[model samples]
Target chain A: MISLKLDKKLDSSEGEFLLSIDIEIPKYSFTILCGDSGAGKTSILRMLSGLMTPDTGRITYDDTVWYDSRQKINLSPKDRGLGFVFQEQALFPNMTVRQNLAYALAKGQHSKEIDLLITEFQLDGLQDRKPATLSGGQKQKVSLARSIINRPKLLLLDEPLSALDQKRRMRLQDFILKAHRDYDLTTIMVSHDAAEINKMAQAVLSLENGKVSRITRPGEMKKVSEMTSGTITKIDESAEELILKISLKKKSGNAFQEEYATGEMIWVSKKM
Target chain B: MDWQPIILTFRLALVTTIILFFVSLPLAYWLAFTRSKTKPILEALITMPLVLPPTVIGFYLLVAFSPAYQFGGWLESIGLRFAFTFPGLVVASIIYSLPFMVQPIQSGLSNLPPSLREASYILGKTKISTLTHVLLPNIKPSLLTGIVLAFAHTIGEFGVVLMIGGNIPGKTKVASIAIYDEVESMNYAMANNYSLVLFSVTFVILILVYLANGGYFNQISK
Candidate 1:
């Protein structure tokens, strides 16, 4: 388990606020920090990765103390033994994809791992190309692959897929999941997409104004399945198909989907 | 035309530029990333050469290298005399061109996104490796600018060399100083030859830097 009691004063778009938290992250679990913009989500990940220091705190992984303000004990990021993927792709622009991965190799570590990563990410043909020549999704994939070249026990991602399109976003999510399971990593990611949280995270820490407002399991999927109904506003007579506008109740927060309806007279529920 | 002065001038510039490249790398890295309270003071001292007259620095070098002073006396005790010598010209040129070498590299380092450094650190690379492999590679244009500026600045310097190195045909008489001596003796042809050579060479060097940095040579990148 990684336990931390952190305190930091930060300035955001809305002004300054104190980000205080006391939380213990379960080992080998996928955790998500969900919040609006400027809610200290990314800052928390940075603090955990040793990229940003807390004003006062004790961060411990098992028995090793990562940081303690009073003891003056702080580990450098290199010693923290983790991987970080920034919001934007942070691949070395001057290096080819293979070279970037090779550069991340530790001493005495073999190049076979680099070859495997390139194949795993489906970047085989693009391995000899620089980052500037790739698309946004391709670049982020390379960034992810490079970060985990050493197979770290921990992974930190800050909105790594926010810039990608829907198709590419889903594609990268699968890659993140595979890496998470392949290494059994203790993953901490900051994201605002609830569906993605539901698909990837085991637990979610919803943040508001630099504070954890709630710990919610992302089971919005179950709720949506239970109460989904939409008025059949239009019917296509040519194909003998009914068009269903599946908007649930106003209280369900606007769950909507369109589907090709059958001609059966199915009873619509009052709650839906 | 005697080529000794021109050769000596290039030798001094080359040596000074080479030394400054190594020295400025560490200095620029610190200035770009440090939170030290004394940064402003140190920065001002390094940049003094840019605004102050070269003769002001030249005057101080003369005082420090003279055998009458304590420093000069100690230097002489070691059987080393920098005053009016080739080594003296190299040292003075380095000081007079310090800012030219440091500023561009510093700005290049600062302009890079912070995530590049943080990403390298999180990947389990040390500070030195991160600098050499990641930070420095991304600032190629800045490094070129610094080298070109320092080399050209040292090549054109006259006041500092005149004060500290004086005039010696094979020892301290660089092209700029030679031009001055030639013009003083009404040797306009010799002065013009030296002047045109210096001008054409520096201009060509600056043009190459501009073209390379502007992506004119970037055909293969895309």
Candidate 2:
């Protein structure tokens, strides 16, 4: 288990705000830090990864004291066993994909494991290519493989799939899940996509104004039906299928989609 | 007509560039990432060479390198003297060409995404390893720019070299100083030869740097 009681003072373009977080993250669970923009989600992830230090509080992982203000003990990020996938992939541009992964090899990892990772991530023919030569999805795959080569105890991902299209996103999501399961890493990710959170996260921590305003298990959280109510405005049957356009409540300008009959009211929140 | 000054100047520039390459690596890295309150002051000091009159820098270095000062006396006792010698010219050249060596590397490091460093740290790599294996390699263009600029700038130096090393032949007289002497003695033919050679060499180096950087003008235009 990783326990944290941390506080930080931040000055943003909006104004100054206090980020006071007290939470426990369970081991071997996929935890998602879910919030709107400027809710301190990325800051929390930085704190966990030892990229940023809390102003005052303690952070402990299992038996190791990662940070303790009272004891003046704060370990550098190098001393903390962790892995991070940045939003931009952040692969070393000068290194080939194989060298990138090889540089991250932890002690006791065999050379065969590098080959296994290259094959598992579907980076077969691109091992010798630099990051600039690879496509977006390929870069992300290489980045993920490099991060986990060390088999970190904790993995932190900062919206690793935000830039890809739906088709590619889904494919990479499966790869991510497979890596997580195979490594059994305690992963914490920051994301705002509700469907992604619901599908992947075991627990969600929602932040509002730099505080954990709500915590919910993915199984117990309210589904799309409870959050959105709309009226069906139009129906299209041109493609040999029925599709309804919904005008949501209080926002009449935008229309959404759900399976419904015209002139009927519907509660639809799932993205089309 | 003498080629000695040309060879000596090249030797000095080569040594200065090589020494500064290693010295500026760590200094540039620190300037790129440090959050210390004195960072602005340090940056200003490092960059002072860019704007300060070369003669002023030469004057100060001359005083410091003189055997009268404690620092210079200590150095003299250790069998090293900087007054009007080849070593004096090198010391002056390094000081005069510091910004050329440091600025590009610092900008290269600063322009990289912070996530790169953070990612390396999380991978459990030390700062030195990350710098050597990751940061420096990725900034090849900038490193090349720094080295070429330092070399060319040192080769073209006149005022600092004149003030600190004087015009001693075969020991401290460099190409620029030889050019000055040829011009003063009304030896236009010799001066022209030196001028043409220096101009051709600097031009070729600049072209090579541009080519190595994938046509710097094209990148800017795009």
Candidate 3:
């Protein structure tokens, strides 16, 4: 199990909002962090990968305490046992595809394992090619292959498919799903595509203004609707005040009406 | 045919090239990655030797290494001499050809994306290892260019060598000085031979550099 609890300030936002979040992920589950750009989704993943530090947080994976601000203990990225795939696909340009994957494997590991990964990713024909010669999708595949060669404990992806075309994105997504299942690895993918999240994520965490709202599977949207009540009101394009309406059941068993502006998406929740 | 000076020139150029490689690697790394407030100041310092006249540098070295000066006195106490020695000539050549070595290396490092270094850092490699394995391999062409330029520049240097090394016949006399001595005594044939050899060597080095750089460009374009 991997658990993260953070209450820290992030510079990407204007004011110091409650960027606090608490999440518990079960083993071998696919979790998606769904948010728009600059929504702290990448920041959370970066902290988990040890690329960035949190001001006040405790992150533990199984028996290992990855980070604990109170204890002043933090592990380096290499020791974190996490595989990270960046948005830009940061492959070493000087090395060939085969050499790149070979470098990532543990020392003394068999060449047959690398050969198998290359064949699985369909990079065998281009093994001798440098990254500069490969197309976008091919480069991304090589990057993914390199990241997984060591078989990390957790997989962290930050918009790895955003640079490719739609077809390539879908193809890579299928590969990611297969890898997740085959390795039984805990995976966390950050993305802005709602459809992609809906398809891949067993659980989605919506981050808005640095706050996370966890939505589980099985009638997740219905629960969200109930929590927000009338806050899901659509935008009234013709309104000057950006009006919203709320229907409440009073003690008399009758519905009561309350109107609010569109800015009240935060206040209306079933659990307060 | 007296080949002593030619052999001496080759040795001088080889030594100068080796020392400059180590000196320029860290310098280029700093210029490429540092965001310090004094980066411009440091860059200007490296470039100062490049733009200054060779004679100016030679004059400074002459004074700095003279027996009367503090640095020279310290060296003399340690039983090491700099003036009129091969080591002195090497020092003069390094200063004269420093920019030729550093500029190409700095440009190569600057062209690389920071993402590559960051990725390596996150993957458990130390800064030194990343530089040796990842950064050096990527900038191989630029390294080759720097070495060639430094070697060629050191081979053709005359003013600095004359000032510091004093043109000792078989000791400090380099190819350029040999050519000068041949010309001064009206030995046109010997001068012609030396000039042709230097010209051919420089031309071949340049051709190799161009071919290497062109190969990289064509591969990337494809």
Write the residue-wise lDDT of candidate 3 on B1-222 in tens digits.
Answer: 788888899899999999989998898888888889998987887788767877898999999999899999999899978899999999888878888898899999889887687667666667897898788999988999999999998988888999999889889998899999999999999999988888898898889788877795577777
lDDT of 2 by residue, B120-164 (tens): 888899988899888989898999999999999999999999999
Give every collision pair in model 1: none
Kindly report which residue pairs in candidate 3 clash with one another: A227-A270
TM-score of each: 0.90, 0.89, 0.79
Enumerate residue pairs that collide in model 2.
none
lDDT of 2 by residue, A1-272 (tens): 99989999977668989999999999999998988777788888898888998999999999899999999999998888888999999999889999999889976778888899997786899999899999888899999999898888888899998998654665677677777888999999888876567658889999888889988896686574344456667776543234455454332235434432223222212235
| Candidate 1 DockQ, CA atoms | 0.80
Instruction: Write candidate 1's Cα lDDT for A96-209 as tens digits.
Output: 999999998877899999988887788999999999999999999999998888988789999999998765776688789888988889999888874477668888898887
Q: What is the TM-score of chain B in candidate 1?
A: 0.97
In model 3 chain B, the worst 10-residue window by lDDT is: B117-126
Tens digit of per-residue lDDT, candidate 1, span B1-222: 999999999999999999999999999999999999999998999999989998999999999999999999999999989899988888899889999999999999999999999988988898999989999999999999999999999999999999999998899999999998999999999999999999999999999999999988886566
Return the top candidate by DockQ: 1
Candidate 3: TM-score of chain A is 0.78
Ranking by lDDT: 1, 2, 3
The CA lDDT at A8 in model 1 is 98
Q: Chain A: TM-score in each candidate?
A: 0.83, 0.82, 0.78
The candidate that achieves the highest TM-score relative to the unseen native structure: 1
